[model samples]
Target: MTSTPPLRQQCPPGACDCHRERLLENPDADLRILLLTRNEEQRLLERLENLKDLADLQRMQQKLQEQLGIRLHIAPGFNEVRTTRGIEFDFEDQPGLCRKTRQAIPAAIRRSMEKNPEIAWRLLDSHDLLGGL
Candidate 1:
């Protein structure tokens, strides 16, 4: 019987190595941004619920895709914005908010929330309660 040689070890380039080292040393060195909008009070709450559900669903979807080599059509919707600073003045327009579909927002939110739950909770908690009509 012939024995095969072990595969050669591969190391990433210098820039990649530097980034990896930095990431390992300081994982939270970078800032993250999150953007959310609500047209109505009820809609905001609904959005938060939807975000949690969507996150769980997508997590399962990703696992299945990786294990079974199956491609799931999650559909394309909304433009998720990412920035170093959370502040962005252009979001005031309805079109910017409207362009984002319900599906995308949850996934985007789930990702952001996972990375930064405190920020997500703070945003969610900021809403005031509405009295019975």
Candidate 2:
């Protein structure tokens, strides 16, 4: 182990313009409280967004059911973007929602192609479909 060095002459608070003079930047109780508050706000916003999405999705599902006379259940928290072409659905339901999703794909494709005649089904996931890379 190396020997500890003894303290030299001490310099006062204003000795250097480092972080020692910063305001409200201390990692103390106040900082912890502030961080917690911010996190809580973000969580609340996320929950509100989730609720909005779920409600909108329910309305869309009702419309589809009325039109097609079939039940299509979408897993919660899925993000969807509706464009002039069609609805772009995104979710993490890797194994659960495939059957229901497949039912919607054909109609979605038809709507997309009808709106934009240039749409190619084989290249649905291509960069051009997403406004280029």
- The regions of model 1 sitting more than 4 angstroms off are 1-101, 128-133
Tens digits of per-residue lDDT for model 1 on 13-48?
A: 531221323333554542111122233323543443
Reference-based TM-score, model 1: 0.21
Q: Backbone clashes per model, in order? A: 0, 0
Cα deviation of 53, candidate 1, in Å: 21
Those runs of model 2 whose alpha carbons end farther than 4 Å from true positions after fitting are 1-52, 76-133
| Error in Å for residue 45 of model 2 | 27
Tell me the alpha-carbon RMSD of every candidate: 17.3, 22.0
Q: How much is the lDDT of residue 102 in candidate 2?
A: 40
Model 2 pairs whose backbones collide: none
Candidate 2's displacement at residue 23, Å, is 73
Q: Which lDDT values do the candidates have, in the order given?
A: 0.35, 0.35
Extract clashing residue pairs from model 1.
Answer: none
